[model samples]
Every structure is written in structure tokens, then in C-alpha cells.
Target: MVVDGTYAKMWISKGILYFVYKEIYEINRIMAKQIVSQRLQLQNENSYPIFCDLRAVKNAQKQARDYLAIEGAYMTTALALLVEDEHSMVITQLYIKTSNPTYPTRVFTNKEKALLFLQDYKE
Candidate 1:
């Protein structure tokens, strides 16, 4: 199943949940929560790894980041963040470190690498 939202699009493949954030004006808490809920439903409550393609995302609000981190701690088994540039990589790293996420997390510039990393969490 695929779900399209204002700033993100989500789908599931090989038992993994993927969310691609579009290049938009802003990303806030509400949108993040919506995406998470949609993803959870798509998986039918079973735990799964998540791959987030944030390469197109220009900026995200603090509230959105916080909400994702907190909620993801319980819902996500592992997280793979696909980032194209150094800035995005740094920002992703900061969030992971600050949030102290429960799952294993990593940042990669290539989608293949991200998917490969997330495969570890696949059952």
C-alpha cells in the first residue's frame, strides 16, 4: 500500500516501510504523526524497519523531528535515512544522537545502501 500526504509519500516493500519526504515549504509535527500512523497501519501492527528518503526535503521543523524520534522509538525496529548531501547527513546524525533512538539508525547517500542496511531488521 502507498499513501501520499502533503509532504511525504509512504509505501511498503519486502516487509519494510518507506517514507519519502517531498521538497516542501515546511514539515511539522502533525504531518510527521500522520505519516507514522499511516505506516503503522500499512504494516498491520507488525514491527518493521523503516527507510526514509529525505533527499528532497529542504527543511524540517523541530516539532516534527521530535515527534518522529519519540514515536519511532517504539514503532520502528531500525531506521535508514537516505541523505544526498553533507548537510542532510549532519542533521540526521544530530537527530539520532540527540534523540537516542532505540533502534539502529544509519545515514547513506544511496538508496541501495540504505535498503541493505535496513535488511538486517527484516524478519
Candidate 2:
């Protein structure tokens, strides 16, 4: 993942390595590149889940929603999220609402609780 920011970090946990870059505004060129590259690198593994908290970021624009939706779709990732504010929930719902055919995402205020339910989730 390529990022022009104050900090770029990647955290690996439970087969999902989350790459977080400092937020940028007005353009999604850099962020989109990172997500696509990361997903490709994660191919042939277990689920590549992504958890994003946008409580303090700039997301007044509609592209933010599309960005998350695209990430979920392309990565086929099951998403788990915690929303501490309305702004974050707005973006979260956008992703949840999309509901891609290949990607199934779940939202939860409680991660541990959600995980327990997911353990028994069968389609």
C-alpha cells in the first residue's frame, strides 16, 4: 500500500492485515490504490476483514460511501464495525446497505458479541 501521509501502518490479526493511512481530502486516488493492492495481496487466504472508524474523518461527500462499498466488494471482506458517532454510522450504513452478492458485512456495537453470533452464522 502506497500512502502520502504523516503515518502509514499495517496491522496483521486473524489473517486480516489492516493497512491504515492518514486521511486525505478531495481525492481518493491514493487510498483506492492502497485498498486494491492490499486486497490483491490477500488473495487465497481466509477472509480479509476490514474495520474502519471514521468518527474523526472528513466524509461529508458521497464518495466516502462508495469507497467503503468498493473495498468490501473488491475484497469480498466481511466487515465488523463500531460507530461512536453519527458521522461514522452514516458511512457504515452506506457499506451495509450495499450488501454485495459476494460480500456479506455485519455491523455491531459489540465486537465480541458479534463474533459469537458469527461463529454460528450459516448460509
Which segments of candidate 1 are over 4 A away from where they belong? none
lDDT of 2 by residue, 86-114 (tens): 55567666656764535556655554644
Q: Please, what are the lDDT tens digits per residue for candidate 1 over residues 1-123?
A: 688876678888887988888886677888778877777777787888989998887777998888888874566889999988888898789878888887899998889999999888988
lDDT of each prediction vs. the true structure? 0.83, 0.49
- Worst 10-residue stretch by lDDT in candidate 1? 67-76
For model 2, the superposed segments whose C-alpha errors exceed 4 Å read 1-8, 19-30, 42-46, 60-64, 98-101, 109-123
Clash pairs, model 1 backbone: none
Clashing pairs for model 2 are none
